[model samples]
Target: MQETRDAFVFRGGAMAAKPEIGSHDIEIRDCDVKYYTKRGFRFRDGCYDIQVINCTADAGGKEWYVEAFPMSFNVIGGAKGTNVYDHDITFIDCIASNNWHINGDSYWNGDGFCAEGTAYNLTYIRCESYGNTDGGWDDKSANPLLIGCIAKDNKKNYRFWSGAPGALLWNCVSAEPNKRGGNSDYVGLWTKGKIRIHNSSFVDSSKPLALNDWRVTPEQIANMNISVNNSLIELPEGKELPAPNYTVSNTVIRPLNETGLSANGVGYKKDMREAQILLTEVRPHQPRIEKEGRLLETKPLNVFSEKNPSGWYLSDWNNAKMKIAKGKGINDSNALEVSTNGSKGGGATYRTKRDSATIKFANFQKSDWALKMSIRTGSTNLSGLELRALTMAEAPKTKEVPLPGTLNGSITGWQEISIPLAKLKASASEANFANFAGFYIRANGSMAGPLYIDNVRLEPMN
Candidate 1:
């Protein structure tokens, strides 16, 4: 394939003058595509045995699926919010790098591989994307299979938008997420489908798996059979990220070094080379992974009344400046603000004043519940906000279990931080906090300064 600039002569404008091809196999092998308006190459009406092999695309703009754009493959097309598909397409050993450019007000720029509007049964073997504006692969479809792919230095890496079902990621790597990205590189939002990721590595993303609590449900994800198995991830280097969020099922996390995955592939671990084969061969002690339990409902967290009886009162944080701006809450309009200036030894604790020793719990299992709080920081600095969960005792004791990620985010707008009730058990005795005084927060060691918190409530895990 000789190098060419703007080699894309095929164009799809309103589907009026699209070229009609034969019904036989269409193959574009070992070619270089450059600069086009809508897409580099497209096959709108679909064909039999479509193969894109050893191709490299650059300078293509506006929804350019350098490899494939299923459903509406022939153009920069498809109605937004429509579920459509194009099928039986395969891309092998291709590279879609720097295929980013802006042409018009309506046009957007850059994507390594993109699928939209119900596209299905597409396969990419050993493909990669780099320096794109959007991400490595932005998908919104069903039954797409990817094997041995790589992504680097894009706004976001693997973005799984709303899709039908059946998405697979195998032996892929997403690294070096652009600092300006709000979510991490491996962003997963669509949860109503069956998604499986195995023997892959997600490197240098702070929050690799961020599915919004309001948008997705555990039952929805579990019912869809979404599982992340034997994957490795590393936090952003030298940065104090809270921790990676793991809200999926059947996830077994291992380190890169432990897998013996050196740069040379010297170790040749069984997990990577024979992953698909080993999945079929399980031992006796192994448990067959399946769907999680039934989902729960969510509601407003109505607490802290004027006449406190359940011992719910505001935290009198020591050496901290605080305020209560009425009518600024999340659902309402009142929010609490706190700035830590003189916190010592474990920082300052902003906990509720207690009187009664215990409060009652619902009949749901502990893991079925979560304490949700809506908080946002004024600056990109305030971090280290810990929600305190205490057990009712002579001196209410805190359990020693690992908590969820701390409130270390710096989002400039309101975002919810959910602590799964399973994580609130500081010790084995508090496993089921039936004898609970109540909850509060430890606001100290303000990394970036003052932060605002509101809409503190206990709701079912959604």
Candidate 2:
């Protein structure tokens, strides 16, 4: 549990190698080191469980060359071609800047950090790397995870060629806005092993590619259940391409240049030349949660099951009055009562006068969750569905969040809607209860129009 600080300011190429440091849990915190004549911080033979937090290292070099020995040096080093392994190490909130090298050179002087031989379980969280000549992160080991990290204006943001497993890039952003001197081969992220990229963005780079050829064969594509959702991939003009080996959903992919599609006897403009259209679809296989006993059920909600009548439900009222009509379905016969007013329009408007049928739950817990429901226009009079959570003995109060406004489409089909639980809690701050109660859905002022709802479920995250 001991903390140490070693802010050594080494002269360029003038520092000598230190003796081996024994294995210990070390925390290198808030240190500013620069201009190392050699490697900045060498992990000695037995150094393990090292955590570097909020540190900054500026490798002062314009171009990396072995001959430029006095001015160019790597930031960290372990003996090359050795069997030494660095494991359980994390670098959080750090910066590695101004490390550059000549184009097309394979030297090690300009890399932010180089991990050789069996390095495992290493992570870089919320770190920044800029102006690095060679690459932002070069890992030749296994089990490296980069989360919420940024590497901008670098020759290569990531270059990993070693045989490693669990090499992942999650919520990372790689951008290269400058396109000069270098060949503009600004690959935002490049990996050569098993990699999983989720919820990440790549913008304005020469080539943003993911290389999975190391482990994946052409035959495996037929037997995999894969899905890609909620990702944004943008490229410089003329570089728009389809995502590899997955169906794209709720994603925005736009290339900078004009291109065309030549498939399925249909052709369309690419990139900026084509109009940007919004298309939304829902896959039924994704799980939804429900309340079970005294806890939120960890299983997906069965919207299609007859026992789980908690499926998406909707109704509509005519005019400005709140009332229940013959078209509305009621789950609890006695709880729901509606009334209508003949306001302004010839069509009668209805509103909910009491609680509707309750979707029973076992218990409630304070956790992050999600609820998704689909709403479709049944009769078209600009209707909406309202959801509320209430205690067993009291009148149910409205849980109003910034749900999507009146959807516009034909009154013939369903539209899928996903609402995050955080957003719902924030908007309905006054009505949310601590105990696991129940939830209900009611329509706004009843119009003559019909409102169809389906696919309602809750999702709880650990």
Candidate 1's C-alpha runs over 4 A off are 1-24, 60-84, 101-109, 162-164, 179-193, 212-226, 235-462
- In candidate 1, residue 195 scores what lDDT? 56
TM-score, every prediction = 0.43, 0.43
lDDT (tens digit, per residue) of candidate 2 on 262-356: 22222111221111111001111211121111233354443322222322332333443323233233231211222234433222211222211
- Total clashes in model 2, counting residue pairs 3 or more apart in sequence or in different chains: 30
lDDT (10s digit) by residue, model 1, range 358-419? 33342233335566666776546554455566554443255433223334454467786777
Cα deviation of 19, candidate 1, in Å: 17
Q: Which one is best on lDDT?
A: 1
Report lDDT (CA) for all predictions: 0.49, 0.47
**Candidate 2, residue 192: how far the Cα is off, in Å:** 1.4
Candidate 1 lDDT for residue 304: 32
Please give the lDDT score for candidate 2: 0.47
Question: Whole-model lDDT, candidate 1?
Answer: 0.49
Poorly placed runs, candidate 2 (over 4 Å): 1-22, 63-83, 103-109, 162-164, 177-184, 210-229, 236-250, 257-462
